[model samples]
Target: MNKTLAEVRTESGYTQEEMSKALGIGISTYNQYETGARNIPVDKVKRISNILNIEEKDFFVPLKFTLSKIKKDE
Candidate 1:
C-alpha cells in the first residue's frame, strides 16, 4: 500500500485504459482509484489481484524497501 496503484499498474504493464476495459469500469473511475482519489472496493481489488495473478496481501506489501529497513532496524 506504500506504493501507489499507478506505480503498481505501470510496473505490472497495465495501462489505465486497458485496466478499465478489463475491469468493466470507466477510465475516469479507474484513474481516480489509481490516483488514490477514491478508496478502492474490496471486490475490485480482488479482481485486480486475480488479473495480475498476485495475492491481495501483495497489494499491501510496500515496494519501496521500507519493510526491509524496518526489519534491519529490528
Candidate 2:
C-alpha cells in the first residue's frame, strides 16, 4: 500500500520538527506539505524523500485517500 508523507516520516523515525530542521524549512511549511495543505515543490519533495529514505513518488499519494485511511483507523 502507498503511504503518506507523514506516515513514511514516522516510520523513518523522524518527527516533523526534525524533518523541518533537516530540510531547512519551517515546521509549518513541512506540516503543510505533509498534510497536503499546499503543493510541495519538486526540490523540497526530493529533499524530504531523501531524509525519509523513501522514493519521491511516495509523496504523490492522494491526500483524500490518506485521510480516509486515517479516519477508518480511528
Q: Tens digits of per-residue lDDT for model 2 on 1-74?
A: 86778888898899999998998989999899888888887788788878877777656733433434344554
Error of 2 at 38 (Å): 0.9
lDDT of 1 at 28: 96
Q: RMSD per prediction, one decimal? A: 9.7, 11.2
Each prediction's whole-model lDDT (CA)? 0.79, 0.80
What C-alpha lDDT, on a 0 to 100 scale, does residue 27 get in candidate 1?
Answer: 98
Off by over 4 Å in 1: 60-74
Model 1 residue 37 CA deviation (Å) reads 1.2
